[model samples]
Target: MAGKETKKGRKTGLDEAAIRGLAEEAVFARGRAYRDEGAVSDVVRRGDTVTARVEGSETYRVTVRIDAGEVDDYACTCPYEWGGACKHVVATLLTLIEAPEEAQERPSLAVVIGSLDRDALARLLLRRAEIDPGLAGWIEAECAAAPGSDADPAPVAAQARAVLAGRYAERDYWDDYRPAGDPAELRDLVDKAVPRLEAGDGRGALGILEAVAEVFVEDWIETSGGYDDETLYPLFQDLGRMMAEAALMSDLDEDERASLADTMTDWDAALAEYGVEDSFALAVRALEIGWDPPALQAILNGEGGKDSGTWPPKGEADWTEGELTAVRLRVLDAAGRHDAYLHLARAAQAHAAAALMLVRLGRIEEAVAYARKAFGHPDDALALARALAEAGRAEESLAVAEAGLSFEPNESVSLRGAHSVVPLARWLREAATESGRADLALTAARAAFAGSLARADFEAARAVAGKTWTSVRRDLLKTLRAAERAPERTEILLDEGLVDEAVKDVGGAPGYAVPEAVLLRLMEAAQSSHSDWVIRVARSRADAIMDAGAAGDYAQAAEWLRRAALAHESAGLIDEWSATIEALIERHRRKYKLRPLLEALRF
Candidate 1:
């Protein structure tokens, strides 16, 4: 998940709110970090698709479909299993969003390919094939396989074998995690099945999944393809999910379903040997129960299916249930089984998805009612509240948002919490203030400050605190004092003009160099009121650098010395300041960088 790391870039041209809506709050925030840190590079825009490599644990290739200047579809070659855009995709999108200029414009693949003549194209293909040993055979196999044909796993199986043999032969090194070449090449083959999704060609997809999985598992067993580090986890996770979705979308007969389920069970057993268990549980469930569980159908038909305890022959509280329910919702919605989708989402506690669906269905009041009781996660309330606000239901939105303040999860309580706590609380405060609900606004303001210790948040809380700023400031200061972020703590106090507080706790330490800008401003602000503290802190800071022979920081030491001199002069200690400067020159005459800086500090 993400936390703030000094938003030092332009606001993204892409819809920040819409992007946030797409990802979990934590993931969105972490993407912000990746973008800020310049992790996204090799950015190239080819018409609607933006491609980049986001450098993290490993360099991941990411592509996002940009339609109407907004994200339409995205994929990342990273092992992130959590729902929503993975950090790599998020980072790439953010690069396109915030720093659009960094993305070089290029012609789309269609344009380039269309412009090429047959001979040129053949030459290009031959050139690439010569470089990549697997490309020649893979292309031959692909060309031989006809589209719209029955399931033919042989071509794909051969392609996998060719790609892997090349990868293994070309491997430069081996380790527990660093597998031969890249699993992403195999994942690229998995992505090949995605197009089959358009026709709901579950049969075609099955052929591809079966072929790829066979090669992947066999490679692990035969060689030291070491899947032990979960280097291959993302590929298998995506494979199983795709298989589940295919089964759900397929109109398989009872026998076909049973066979598919057995395939998943076998794969699960094989993977368990390498510390991966329940590898195909979701796929197995999808194949075994093709939406005809008597209990599930009964509930969907409104025939008393409220047995939450036995929804999945009794509910399972892990991530699998959520994933399974998600697939069910997708299939049911596609089939226009709106009523069934609603019932299943509620049973699975997928309140956020259900509430959003209800809002779309224009059952606004029902959506609000469901969300009021659906405090499953911040998103549960967030989805409905955002919907209501967009619909001009100001009062209802405030009510939902207020209830959400109490539902903050432990994971998101940190200032960097993905709880959407900061933004959600800010929205509530501003809207409540506009609606003349000052008390509500004030409470929301407090929540915002607690969630994000930004100076802006602090000022927003101060604005809404009315006559309670006295007590409110005390509580906020407590929060700041206890926070792990020392720089933020100092910035907030300094910004509030609490020089004494900033000086005592933040800058009092001998070697603790508060940011140079903050230290410089602190001396300027407290020269008259807290000159002694400034002199001690500033002199100590400059002395630390000079004493440590920090050649690169001599300029900063000189600046700190100048500020300390001003503070000393303000306290009528100019003579003392001169003595201190002269002694500093003699003590480190050997330090060439320090000599001139010290001599320049003298009157």
Candidate 2:
């Protein structure tokens, strides 16, 4: 299938093996199912690129760019962050390979847009905006005002301030301040200021940004009672971009530039009041407006110098001397001062940075050694693994990941570990399979599943286990059954349709000590074939809950009793159901708080 040309004269670089190699076994299987089930549609091929929509739980746009006999790039709009091509992309590729005739002839977006007249385009935008207010706001911000309109800046500033004020008005202390605002109003305000900056109204744009920044900082302080990196980082990034664009205006005189710089400096002062030292806006503005290195360094080092009590500001303040140094390093790197960056990073024991620099300088051996040393720090494990894998040392990459996997706390099993280790395990599995070590591949797949289980990532675990499940089912079941968390083991059993084993593990005499939620699930699972067992388990659970002797406890007991009664009724055991309810009421009759609730349950 290598270099096979389709009727469109584009070579199909992807075959079954290549596509399978690109995706996880489960992802590939799911993608194949999707293709067979006709989930991929609206496929269009242009030159070497194929675009299609893959319908899953959500419709995702998949694009695959194939060049010659190799898959160049694969992307999908779905939020599948498993560190590889998502199922949608796989599905699209499969459709392209199996059903080339289904490739629909779609007009290029440029052609379609060019065909529409101004009025038609406006109408189309209006219709789209009616559906998506965020889109409307963006369009309004971008097109509503001309670059050098006679309109006063005050009104625009007020409009932008009003947008922020309205957004923050109802917020309270417990609310999380999200960077993603109400219908992109914050972005709209920023976008509106862009045209002013483009028109050489640097001062005006700076004013709007300053006002918005003030509101953002104030609201953030009020709602969270502290600064947060997640919110502030993005806000400052936007501000920096605006500052960069405004600083580029050729028509702006020195006075206007100074005014813009002053506006940014004021923002830095405002952040200082809250003990924040990391103001990217001030740093970028200083850099843009040609401030000397020492002055720029002072802005990053906090206004009071390094000896100040607030030099290393604590808690939610993203700016620190170390961060400043990193930024400086980045600037140095960007300015082609690689030697300086490498020296600084090495001196600071910023091994990750040093390794990255070495890699950039094509010093592969030095980069690998630095990466290995960096992996001694647990935080650098993922980066080291990625670096090694990228350098074609797949075995070493897997080894680095395996070493780090044991470092994760074993207090609970969830998919958190899967994110870091699953990719490595997959790489190892693929390599082992290719090297004719199916046993080693199976072992790697098991390790991946174990990591997934630790992370509570059952879907990923299931996916990893899919290929070898039939052969290893008994061993896996034995291992799960012997696990520490009964609920987790029982869940796996139930998910695998091992109902009898799940029933045996979770269903027993009174006083089963698993969590109430797990107990209820076991009872539900047994309700079909083991109705009597469900009734007994539910009664035992209700008794335990009622034994707490609190008002809340009695309410919970009522819920469990209701479940038992339903199970009895479903099994046509009316007498048993009636008896169970009567017994429940008798047991809780003395608790006057629960009397009203019990009376309502009278059959």
Candidate 3:
């Protein structure tokens, strides 16, 4: 846990809420079980990172990066899907929260490396290579001589292929960081090009990127169960992007650029064969046009143009390549080239960025005007609105927000994810309400409720409804009871003490279909008054697991069986509970591991 007071409002490194947020109900249960059983060991915290080995089916190496006392990123060498955080990560986090003393303090990797002299480092590297044979090829590639222009790229390509291939037997492709992107073996190799780019060795960077991209795409095999889309596939896209930036910084002649363009085209075709579409299109365009078209330059110089490819650029990606423009803008911004940053951002149609820059430049009118014209999405609008509100232009902020909403923009990205959280509308509602514009607030609140269907939004809408609450609540409840709204509605109903409605809705549905928490809460709440229903639901769930002879699921089955037993006792059917357990024990008699669990649930 990040046990420090910070400006970001984290009270500790981790809490139950934080850890539980990292996983699903069932996953947290398993992780808690693992933690209670001491499955996580050798826990170490280094800087903002925590690393531990979790004894799951196999020992999984887990690394969690904490920032501002929250999980910024995490990875585990386990083939877990569905749940965002795997069981190993959950177990490790549980260990951090509940058993902080188990984690040993360690020097950060940088500090450790800094303390090592060249001779020690060499010895350490040799030792590592001795332990992992795959590292030898990697070390060779890292120590390879940097070839200048006109040098062959084959050596790099061959070494990359050999290193990746040699690493496969040991790789096992266990890490499925998924949304965070997997740590491919090529990552270290890919990183070598970054410093070259930073040093303005564009051609050299290109050589490294091209060779590595070739080898990575063609030779690097993903052995994990998840799709490549969730792993190294995105890195391949990043290669295209990095190469584009490198090409931009390179001073290549027209022929060289054209040749590079063809090479990119060939790479794109190769990627297309692998189910990737237009992977190198941006890089090829970067080489072909070089971002210096006369029309684009006119706009960059703050000059008007009749054919500047849609002036004001809709503040979005133009035919010239938005992603490439973003790369250049980032470089300029990093170099303190403020004017150049604005030019590139505007020219590249990065409307949101351009507007934010205008706002920071004290040009509120321009920012509001520009943002309204090309509000990329709800987030863009929300950003400008907040800036405007912060700038004391509340009315302007409200106006811009309304205009942005007119585009039917998707929800603003938040912890609930982009699809579920209607942040823009929610913000507008709060802003409008604070400004005493109840009507506007009500409108925004309604929009938020419609999008989110969340209990908070529903309550917000009700609090603001005034005289119309009766009708509004009824309508909202009706909508929330729709087929697709089962999960959210069940939660709301349970919270509102509408147990009968919740029972009928949840009871008619399959036990597996309802949210586990909702299902369990229903069982807990109905244990006395609706004990028969609880018995049916819990027994059905436990029977499903036991009937399949699923050894790993016996614990979960035992949980349901206990719930069933409690319900049976509540309903004065304790004998029935014992009879059910005996029947299950006899029916699943061949499942030696599950019988003991069934016997334990006899009470």
Candidate 4:
């Protein structure tokens, strides 16, 4: 499980065990798959940290901070909140572990900036700022308060407020990136204020953060259908942390410190003032900054006063007591009050937390009970199944896992949810094999493969089938062949290196309207072993496309004819190539618009 060594003799800071420890088995497998599929790129190493970009639904930048051969911290731009390392982080770690040479040594940005002269650095800043107005504002604000200049936080605060307010007008419901004028600008302002707080300007920095927070509260709480909450909640959390940091500065007066503490702890008044039901971020911040326990508990228990009627009053289904109990459990967990956390978790039916806590406390039987009670959730069932199998209860484990697989509607399971199935499938395979039930294993393998294939995952299918593949290969093929989508069957055939079978399967279908890419794959597969068959199939496909008489169809027909000619020539049948080209031109001769396209095809 040791990581591979690079040419420089440095270990990759990761290994199989470390990766497995960082994520669930399913997530680790996905990360490994991503690495194998070449989704990780631009990996760079600097000391103990590795940075890379992983391509998923969108390209996400991932960074892993390693310390003493363990993952200290890891983050990805992808929004996964499952309390574990995301697939992208896992993929980046795998890339570093498996191919250490792929990650080049990179200089830290601070080091690179320090190496530059003031003028050169300024030029660099200006160039970067030209493309980003937010960066430009930051530079201007910082420069305005440079060494000899009178420092003022007011102008910086005003500029940040303007940037934040501009978001209201630039709002677009359709754009995901700039959904609210780039919330990163607000974060940048917060970052810039940090140095000021460290330089004994606690009050000034606090002013700037307060202004930003006010704008966020106004947009989020005062508006009808507010701006994006996802963007705003993180900013509020940042503000809370900054406020706490600023409050620690020695320059702040006792009165100022008390006022900040009040702000942090007074969730009830804030909720009333804003006329909102909850501000989870504020509640978290209160716990983080060590607010008064009694007041914080009151807020969590919903002893907070009624709404201020700034907006309409809450309806019957606004925010339930169960939801409040869940939040309180989180607060208790954060406060390290394990007894309170477990008590509330059970009361709230927060079975996941209860199971985890029981497992942590070495009460395995209780943990298993909770997990079974929550078997309708895939994660809980997975936990129970893994625990049972590890304790040599294979039969019960497989039964629990099979039940968990039915939790979600088959047609509606998302790709993320599908990952939860991987571990269950693995457990079933292992259980079946251990009990000398090869037939049972084969059945599970085939079912898993069919499910994966339905989700367009040939890799998962193959992994599920493993050594049982040869025994079930023919059956799997027959199942695919009987599927309604011809393309799906053809794809599985092509993937298995059944080139002749794939070509014959698709080619024999007379009017199926096979995808052009599939048709091209068919021709490519047949060209070597069945060149004559390639010519015939390509010519027939071209004829069908040309018969449609659309300009697009004509172009497609000409391309297929070109491939047919190449197939003929490759077989040393020069006359066949020429004859096929001639016949195509004659067949489409009356479609004058296609003449120019046909003439361009060379034999």
By TM-score, who's the top model here?
3
Q: What lDDT tens digits, residue by residue, belong to model 2 across residues 477-523?
A: 66666676644666676767777887777647663555455566666
TM-score of each: 0.61, 0.48, 0.76, 0.46
| lDDT against the true structure, each candidate | 0.74, 0.61, 0.74, 0.63
lDDT of 4 by residue, 421-465 (tens): 544555565567677766655555655655554434444445556
The Cα error of candidate 3 at residue 575, in Å, is 4.0
Please give, for residues 1-603, the per-residue lDDT of candidate 1 as tens digits: 222111333233475666776776447767877888899999987777778999998888988886765678887867576789987887777666666678777889999999999999999999999898778767755653335766577777788776666455533344333344565667777777776765667777777787777776676555544435455677778888888887888878999899878877887887888777776788887887677777777767756634632345553445565577688777778677898888777666667777888888989898888887766456556667888888888888889988987876533211112455777788888989998999999998988888887788888989988899999999999998887764567778888778788777554565254655566676798888888777887778788878888775676678788888898888899899989988889999999867987898898
Give the lDDT of residue 287 in candidate 1.
84
Clashing pairs in 1: 2-30, 310-314
Going through the candidates in the order shown, the clash numbers are: 2, 7, 5, 0
Error of 2 at 544 (Å): 15
- Give the alpha carbon lDDT tens digit for every residue of 1-603 in model 3: 345432332234677778878788768778887888889999988888889999987888999999987899898977687858988899888787676777777779999999999999999999898888657765556655243334245656766676555444443345432322245555666777787777677788888888888777666534322235445677778888888888888889999999889988887776676677776787888888785676666665667655564432444444435466677765565456677667667655566778878888899988887886766577778888988899899999999887666555443211111332278889998999999999898888887887788889999998888998888888788778874754577777887788888787776444676777678887888788888888788878877776776676788888887888888888888788778788888888888887787788766
